[model samples]
Each structure stands twice: as C-alpha cells, then as structure tokens.
Target: MFVLWDADGNEIRDEYPPVDPLDILRNPENAAFNLDTIIGRLKELGGSDIVALHQLAQNHYIVLDASTKDGRHYIVRIARNSVTSSTSARISNIRSYVRIALDFFRINAPDGIGSISSFKSTANARSGEPILGPYILPSGLHTPSNVFESIEEYFRWLISVKKTSTTVGTTKPDLDEAQVTLKKLENLISESVSGYRYDAELLRGVPSHQDFSGHNVFINGEGLITSVIDWEFHMVKPAVLAADYPAWIRYNGTADPRFVDKTSQFSSYWMAGPLDAKRLRQEYDAVVKKEDPEYHRALKAGTFCRMAEEWLLSDVVDIGCRRMKAWLENSLE
Candidate 1:
C-alpha cells in the first residue's frame, strides 16, 4: 500500500489487502498505515506526478510510476518492511550485491544486461519510521541474459562445492525419501561422468540472478532490453549452476505461448526458435564444452544436482518438485 502523486500534485492512493484470508486473520494490524511513511517520503523527494501505481503480488511491493516536479519520470519500488534493523539486513546486503553486479554487467556486458538507477533509503519525516526502499529504477522493457557463458563457469564451481560441502544447511524434516532418491541419482551421475574435475578459481564470485525470467525482464522499442527488476534473489553462484537458462524457459510446458513469444523476442541470444528443452540443453552442452572439453559429463551431472537441490530446498510440494523428480529418474535410466 502506498500513495503516488502526479506532476500536478494530484494524489493517487493504492491499498491492496492480502489475497489470503488467513494472512489478514494472522495479522489484523498489518492493514493500517502501511503507506504513510512512503507517501511522506514521496512528497519530500518531489515525486508528484502519478503515471501508474500497482501492487506486485509476488513480493508484495508497491510499484509506483510517477514524475518529479522537473518532469523526470521514475519507477519507485516501496516494500512494506523497514530496512534499518538487523532483522532485515539480508535484504540490504542482497541489494548491495545486485548493485555491484549490475555495475559490472553494464561495463562488461552492456548489450546483455539492463541498467538500474542509484538506490536511496530514508525514513518517514513525520514518524521517523524506516521503509525498505523507495529505490528508483529506470522504467523500460528489457531481456534476460540468455547467453549462458556469462554464468556457466560459476555454476560448475557451485555444483562441485555443493557435492563436497560439509556445512550444507540443515536437512529438511520430510526429505528422507527425497534424500534417498537424490543419493541414487548422485551415484549414477558419479559413474557416468567420470574424470570430471571442478576448478574453484575460474571466474569465482560471479553474480547470478537466480530468479531470472520474463516476469522480471522488459524489452524496449528497439527490441533491446532496457531494464531487469526484482533483485531480491540475486546471488554469487558458480558458473556451472548459474549458467542454466531461466527456469521459465527451460520448463515452459504449461506456460502461455504469448509469454514465450514475448521472452523470445528479446532473448535473441538463446531463443532463436520455439522453446524446446532438448535443443536448449544441447545448446548449453555446446557452451559447456567450449568452456571445458571434458565438461559434457559434468554438465549433465551438474544439471541434475541443481534440480535435486531445488527439490530439496523448496518448502511447498508443487509441480516443480514432481518435474524435477521425473527428470532426475529419467536421466539416470
């Protein structure tokens, strides 16, 4: 929930109640005064022109399209939570990492990645209450970096670490059966992908937007990507694990064709034709081979490892888990 003002200082307020009734019942107090601080800050920032205001359900962030007194348009992302305390430090850290990575990508892969404006945090002038972000990002259409080379090396290193890491997070309580299934799959991969060596030093600490998808990317009039939003899930991952195409493109069996078309239009580097998992995997295989001649076996195994990791870590039982399980079993056979 937040307020937006148009260039003429015409106020527009948006209040979205949680979709789930349980959410309301659980925290009735959550409804009141969510946007006061943000509204005040908007006023201070001289952002008065309201072009658009809407709530994004995926993250519960209010996306406000408004213009300043000087007629400069900006996209303001306002989160419900405050960013000042230790409890929300992870959010700040992730944003910081993303900022650095975006800067790197802008210089290194200008055509591959979109740009973002500087982020600023402030408290409501009246109440002194902190808000997560009034972060301003450029509003424009963009495409994902479908080119796998950018993160392929990083993913391979990540798979090796996960395979050998002793400090893996606590095991899920109901994953006994899943764990057994994964062990079998792992053993099969180990046997099939013999002599696979992982280099930890190749392009270490490369950043990957784990949730890269059409939903977060936008394409402009020139068919070039102008922006990539939603940086909450960005992380530094090994090239091998990070090199995979977006999950949406890889697993689009149930996605809307229109959605696929939109993604393909801007993701020219990878989506040269209709979305085909086999063909995409083949393309990725070629990419892996180019990076390391002996990585064919490792690439297949690493993909399975990634699917297994996703299955194990997901909190909800959904079609994704079923698909991963089916893919893992089929690959082993």
Candidate 2:
C-alpha cells in the first residue's frame, strides 16, 4: 500500500513530481534575484494576464494569481533566496531535484540527507532524518552531508559529544552532573533496544514537514490536496523525529496538543495558526487512525523518542536534565 501525505491525500514521489500545480523560484547568483525571473518562468508555464497578488509573508516569497489564455486559474509562489554556489559542478546537480519529497525516499531513490540545493542525485537528504551534527556546527552538506551513514554511528557520536560538552564547561560543576545524566539516558535506550526491540522501529527514515499545519494545506472542493507548500524545512528524518501531522501536535517531542482559535470574520486561512485548528487536529487524527494506523502510533511515541535529543542538546541544564529524567521513566514503562 502507498503511504499517503495526509492519510488519504495524494502520493508525492521524489522521482516523478507533478508540476505547479506548484512552482519554485530560483536565482543562481548568491546575490538576491528579482521578480523578472519569476515572471519569465510564469509565461513559460502558459500563464498570462498575470496578476501579482499582495505579498503574503514578509521576506519569504511573492504569491501570484494568474490565468491561462484558456480560462484556467493558477496560484504561483515565487520564493526568494534559493541556494546556489560558486562551484559549477554543484550547480549542475541541483538543477534537477524533485519539486517535493513527501516521503523518506523509499520509492526507488537513495536516502536524501543533505541541503535541498546541495549537489546530489536528489534533494531529500537533510541529515538522515535525525539531528546529525553537534548543535554548534555551522555548515551543511559536504558532498551531500558529511555525517554518519547509519543509526549506530549517531549513537556513538552523541556519546562522544558528552565529553566535548563537558570540556566546554571546564570549571562548571554542572557539567559533571550533566555527563552522568546523558550516560544514564543513553544506557536506558540501550537496555530498551536490547529487550523490547525499540530501535528496530527506527531503522529507517520517515517524512517530516517543517510547518505541518492547517495553513500549509491547499485542497480543492472535493478535498484532494492541490499542493503542500513550505518544503523549505520539510525533511525525511530518523523515525524518532518523524512528523506526519501538524507540528504543534507533538512539537519538539513535547507531545502536547496545542491550538488557538484565531479565526477572524475574513477567512479561516488568514490567521496566525488558523481558527478552529484544534478541532481540525482531532479530526485529522481520526482520519489517520482509519487510513494510516502505524503513523498514529508514532504520533504518540515520537515525542518521547525525539525529546531525548531536544532536551539534551537544545535546553538548559537545570530544566532539560530534570525533565529528561522524568521523560525516561515514562518511556521505560
């Protein structure tokens, strides 16, 4: 069975991507490009009498609503700051990437684990579906990401980071305590893997959307998805950080349901988080349980699994270590 985007939504393959229906804007020069590139491409797509709608998001992209000569309509997004490089070889490779990933590259493509515009056979590679590097590293893919190739490699890397982080602490006593807590968490996961086959579930990558929410979803009257925008941070990640639903549902592996009804009299789509979003989340889960049950299980488990990295690497020692200890107790259960 084909794994759908939103349970019953259409399949988005990395190999054969359907066109604009979605359109991405690009400039090869590192310096910013203008609307001319977008307008030229729009005409190529057979859209004329182009109408530039008011800007949607600040400093992100310009949205254009246009009509074809044959009386059809189109919604086009001219995104800014597409990645390019001085290297001719790398530019040659990025010219032909999938318009969308919507998957973990399981359908006849290598695992995509690098920058979207990086040199590669595909653009889906963005850190092996997990947090691959130390939090301080200031670089992206080197020949499609200079990171580990397997799950076990990342485990060992984290263990090594525990030492480096402590050294950075030098005089702080808290570093010693943090080392102990990190080791305890690692051992806890190891024991679970040996006895309960937990790691077996995370052996492969899974699809993750950067902004998985009601706002990014575009659908037709019949409820078929026209396109999923915001693939900028969308990725295929290790199953632990996998998110096949709205990001706020299991945000940062916190696993708490979060929603705010900001609907105005204007329209449901024109809000910060969308009006009645929590209701929509509940409805989305019900649909998933029927159409994609396995993902539903991950929906709950991912918070705990994903929180390990987030709590340890991204949080304060005082709160992160204490919260992580409690989290481990529940996860071991």
Candidate 3:
C-alpha cells in the first residue's frame, strides 16, 4: 500500500494518508515522500539503468537494482515515509561518525570485519555541496546522529528520550513491566558508571554494528562476507557495549533452532579463514578484561542499558520492550 513500481521500473510512492510535514520535521522517523524524487537524486549520484524493483519488506522499503552504462550494478533502496525525515546537520554528523567507526574497524580487523560498501550521499558525491530536498542516502540507509560527546552524554539522552516517549497500553502488562525494569536498570547504570569515561587501552572505542544479523549481511560462494549492509544503527561504543557476539548467536530461547543453525553456518563461513565465533568472543573478552578487571559487571550493565535505549527509540515498542525485559532478566546475571 505504500509504494508501487511501473513497467518502466520507475517508483511511485503513495502518501495518500497525507502525513504532516511538521511531524516529519519534528521527528524524521515520521518521514514519507515521493520515491521518484529520490530516484532522480540517485541518478544525480551516479545510478542509472533501472532494471527491477524488488520489495524487501512490504510497506517498508523496496530495492531497485540498476546498472551504470559501464555495467556496474547498484542497489537503490527506497524507504516508506515512516523511516527518516531529518535533513539536517545531525544526520550528517551521524554519517561521519559511522564512517569513522567502520573505517577504524576495517583498519584494526581487516580479516574479521566483513566487506561493506561506503555510502555515497548526494552531498558527499557532489563534493560536500548542499543539495535540495530531503537528504538522500545511498541504498536508503537512515543515519541520524543526536551528537553525544561521551557515554555519559549518551546516557542522559537515553533517559530523556525514554521518559518522554514511553506510553502505557491498556492490554500490555508485559510492556508496563518492561518499562519499570528498564528504569531500574538505567538507574543502576547511572549510579555505577556515571562520569566514568570508558578509556580501556584494549577496548575504549571499538566499532559496533549494533544491528549485525544475517538479514543485514550478504555472503558469497566461498563463505566469506561479500557485503555488510544496513549501517543505520552503527556506532563507536565501549568494548563492553560493542564487543558482544551478533544477536543471532545469543539465542533468546524463542528463536527457531533450524534458522539459528543456518545463520550460524553463514556466520562461520563469513569469518572462517580469519576467525571463528569462539576465538572472536575470546579475543573480545580478553581485551575487555585487560581494559578492566571488572569488565563482566560493565558488560552486564552496558548490555542492559543499550537494550533499554533500543526499546525506547524503536517504533515497535511491544517487541522492543519485550526484548528489553527478556535481556534484562536473562543476560544481567
């Protein structure tokens, strides 16, 4: 119901419900607009020869596969209006931050970090010149940065957002419980680590693809990671916060074992030559402990804090809140 593609493979995005521009301006998460304009901008940014439109998620986004005249395939992702609306410096700062983090990971863990394409925003492609219309990112990745100078700054922002954004539902007792649990955890973290700047020699500012899962990555014939996509939630966080295994391996007990096994295989293949999951976890743990003997305590606290933040910021509060509650109880031990 959100987007359609024509015989010419051009996009037609419907905003028939007519979302308020002010709402989009206030929170880019409410953004929705014409996909054709985005396509035009992509063309300006060196994409052409539109071939097919493959829907990635119904009513969410679509991927447009195109080739340059020189035969270079490009994946053009178009999101529904409910994704991002921020076209300001905040988004730019976030993009720069993620780029720096990814670059750092590439330098430090060239074998472990998977291959991924760098984003080419319209502005960046035009040599940092200003562009009209909403900020158009390559592959439609939504990157928004609220600018936190330190982990303490991030925590304050998280608390403020959670307090302002949480809503009570009549039928969702579990959600209510999650909110309460999250508040308690947040308080604990604030008391334990407030003003404690993370400065571990082995683990201070490591890159984390916060949403690193099978869905966001692509693998090749040889079982190596051909591409890692979806840098929307990328950040440079503390080793305790960033160094955990991918969520797929965490096995919340509700995940299908068959699917988990498949994903595990893919992950193993992706890092087979350079590393394995056991070695990766061991290396991360060793570094974390070297940085702080009480690293396990920090890891438990940081993991809970991050999950609570994700719950607060996510649009799907029911699922997010459930995850917060589950992880708070299960992983905090």
Candidate 4:
C-alpha cells in the first residue's frame, strides 16, 4: 500500500509491522465512525469556535454537525473547496477526487518526491507563469521539475524557491539574507547526520502525514481521539525529516535556549500550554526511555534532523530560516 526507502533512495522492506492500512481499519471502533464516546477520554483539546471557522475557511474541511431523527450524533465533513452552488465547481472537485483516488491506488516504490497529478500551477492564466506540477508546497513554493533527491538538495531548492519562484527571482536584501541563513542551517543539519550511525535512519524514507494538527483531530466529550481528519497532503520522506510533534502538543518548540533541541528536556508529547508542554516533553522521555529505548535513542539523535524538517515545512521560508540559524548556532556548536 505504501513504499519505503533508505538513505540511498533504494526500495526497502516495511519491517515495522508491515505498512498495511487494513490493520488500522480492522479495529472495530475506528471501523465505526461513532464519534460520541472514544474521544471523550481526552481531557483538553478544542476551545475556540471561531478558530474552527477559520479552519473551515482555509481550503480545508467544512464540518457540518448533523443529527438523525433518533438523536444519533454525527459530524459530516467535506472539503471546503468541494462545497459549491454551481454545477461547474462541484464537477471540478469531483474530478479532483477522482485524481486523488487514482493516485492513491497507483502507489509503488517512488524514488523522487511530488504528486503525480498534473494541475495548473496558478489558478489564473493571466499570471503567465509556466504551469507547474503538484510539487508546489502548501506554502506556495514550487519544487523543481526534477524532484528533490535528498534533504540537502531540498534545502537548497527551498531557499531558491522563495527567491526565484516568481517570473523574476527576487534579489531583495532580506530574501538574500534568508537564503544565507538557510544555507548555514542546512549545513548544520548535514553535519549532524554526515557519517553518523543513524544517518541512514535519519534519511530513511517512509509515508508520512503532512499536517497532524489539533483541528483535524476530533474527540468526543471524553478524551479518546475518536477520529483524525484531513489527510489530503501526504508525503514520502525521511523519518527525521518527517519528525514533528503535532500542533496540539506544540509549544514555543523550545522556550529555553539551553537544550539545543536536546532530550535533556525530555517529556511526553501532548498537551496545551508551555508549562504543560515542558513537563510532558520530559515525562515522555522517562517513559520512552524505559518502555521504548530504541525510539528514545532515535529521538535523541534526531534533534537536528527534526528541526531541519520543521524549517522546510514552515509556513514562510524567510522567517523559518532566520529562526533556525539563531537556534542551531548555539545548539550545534
């Protein structure tokens, strides 16, 4: 169903429990979409409704709360872009769904990155930009026609994408500085993994979710994570590169500058505030250390790796690069 690759981009076996989607669906509660109870086990999650609306409007899901005559609770979700009063728009979204389903079935061991779908790079033709592929990220930066070969190559492409994705690449001073900062940070990530024991694992490729955020996750009155929605943008990438603690658990990433993204501040992942984040991040460490020592070690070695992945996936390139350089200079040195 999914492909796996090592640092060298060669096909590998999915040794970890065999990547089968059915194994997940075989679980009865998940098989049934009953959102009423499982999520109720969770203590804290969603708060603001306006935030929910914001999520709805952002080319994401338009969630409809509905109840049957029997008072059975149900939540209906559809792509925001798919909701349409006109026949044309609905037809287009239908076409998009067809493309996505076809792509899903055709998955094999692909070495390069980017979606197989061909779509107009920009919705407007007046822009005169040569049509690009689906490789354009959620941030609007386009990947090269030749897909990114490795993380180092991706870092370079990312810096260039910001500066040059326009018809005329920007030569602005700030963007240039951003490029320089990104380059330095990229070098730090490269150095951290080069010739290291876990370098292969750091660069090993696997199927990963693009946005594992709070909004997409649904819980009932209790705390169980009954459902997780929004899997439209999935990618195949290295493990460390895909490593990010989801948004609900995300804090300032690191409020203190001392750890350099180290496990010294080890705790469980998952919670709301900065204070809780710290304790969980630490508490997670002790538990992982005793329970899953291998994962704990991977977490320890992947500090730089995870940070690099985060930088690439940042909402804006310039801001992400600048902050990355500032943090790593102290941590990596």
Q: Write the per-residue lDDT of candidate 3 for residues 33-98, one digit (tens) a residue.
A: 344564555465554643333322223333444345555544544432221223332233223333
- Tell me the deviation in Å of residue 302 in model 4: 2.2
Q: Model 3: clashing residue pairs?
A: 28-85, 31-81, 32-81
Give the higher-lDDT candidate: 1 or 4: 4
For 119-184, candidate 4 gives per-residue lDDT tens digits of 335566633322212354553545457656676676666555544433222456655666676677
lDDT of 1 by residue, 177-220 (tens): 44454466456545433434445432233345655554455433
Candidate with better TM-score, 2 vs 4: 4
Q: For residues 1-333, write the lDDT of model 2, one tens digit per residue.
A: 111111111122212112322222232232233445444554565546444322222223333344555665544443332222233322221211111222342322224332233333336664342333221222231122344455445555655555455322554565665566778877755654444354534445555554544445553333334466766654445554553444322322333212111221111222213333344455556655555565555554554445564444331223224444555566567
Tell me the whole-model lDDT of each prediction, alpha carbons only: 0.38, 0.40, 0.42, 0.43
Stretches of candidate 2 exceeding 4 Å from the true structure: 1-145, 166-170, 194-202, 207-235, 251-282, 297-303, 313-323, 326-333
Model 4 segments more than 4 A misplaced: 1-136, 144-147, 163-171, 252-271, 286-292, 317-325, 328-333
Winner of 3 and 4 under TM-score: 4
How should the candidates be ordered by TM-score, best one leading? 4, 2, 3, 1
